[model samples]
Target: MSWADKPNGNDMARRAGASRSDFDGDFAALRQRGRHLIAEIVRLSRQLTDLQQAIGSRRGAPGRGSVSGGEPR
Candidate 1:
């Protein structure tokens, strides 16, 4: 059966047995939480890119090799 036509509260733990209003509230809360998480991920990705660029610049200079000087440690 379709979503609306199906019985409320399936085998899931959600207010599955609750009314449509309850289900809508739950869905809205989940959507908001997902949006917040996505924003956090984007922020973290920008920070990670900045860190990588900093590392690249630091290592780009010559004579930045290990103290072992190409010989196996």
Candidate 2:
């Protein structure tokens, strides 16, 4: 393209600034979403750990009879 077809320096600067603003906005939104997902993961992990512990308590402690092999001698 001819030089005249190219944007002037001021126009180019404005466009660059706008593009940078868009990127910054997008990154901010992404970071917020990441934080939300991390919180959700932590909450779910805690719930699962609580459930596992509850189930384990109901099953009683492991004993020789609970082993995979036949009854202990």
Candidate 3:
């Protein structure tokens, strides 16, 4: 029978040197890192939204000066 006949046929790479356990460990580490990065992105997005809203409110105020001086566009 061919080596490909087994369930873990494609796992010959492990026999060569790297084991399936090693692959699993690496995958787990990477998954955890990805989760952390996603959380950070979400936090930063909220902060950015808050800053934009604050700026928008200030600009909409009557007293705040516009980029085009005091005159109307």
Candidate 4:
């Protein structure tokens, strides 16, 4: 290889810096996505709890389409 083709200290440092910047950006994006997913999971959990309570209340009511075993056939 030519002497000019050899990567010097400054060139290597710049490449390392660019790679670190890219990694940091990717990590931040992943963390943000994870937080959003966790929030969605919490919201869904609350909705499920509410639906279960509604079903439980309906089970004791008369002629409201509530089945016997609480399971669909």
lDDT of 4 by residue, 1-73 (tens): 6334645636666666676676587568668878998999999988876766677576654333333446553
Q: Count the backbone clashes (under 3 Å) in each candidate.
A: 1, 0, 0, 0
Q: Which stretches of candidate 4 lie over 4 Å from their true place?
A: 1-18, 61-73
| Candidate 3 clash figure, as a count | 0
lDDT score of model 3?
A: 0.64
| lDDT order of candidates, top first | 4, 3, 1, 2
Comparison by lDDT, 2 against 4, better one: 4
Q: Roughly what TM-score does model 2 have, to 2 decimal places?
A: 0.58
Candidate 3 per-residue lDDT, tens place, 2-64, comes to 323534736676558877797787668668878998999999988876766665566674543
Q: Write out the backbone clash pairs for model 2.
A: none
Determine which window of 10 residues in candidate 2 has minimal summed lDDT.
Answer: 63-72
Give the candidate order by descending TM-score: 1, 3, 4, 2
TM-score for candidate 4, please give it: 0.58
The local distance difference test score of each candidate is: 0.63, 0.62, 0.64, 0.65
Write one digit per residue (lDDT tens) for candidate 2, span 1-73. Answer: 6334645646766666676676587568668878998999999988876766555555663432222334334
Q: How large is the C-alpha RMSD of every model relative to the true structure? A: 9.6, 12.8, 11.4, 12.3
Q: Candidate 1 or 4, higher TM-score?
A: 1
Question: Where does candidate 3 stray beyond 4 Å?
Answer: 1-15, 61-73
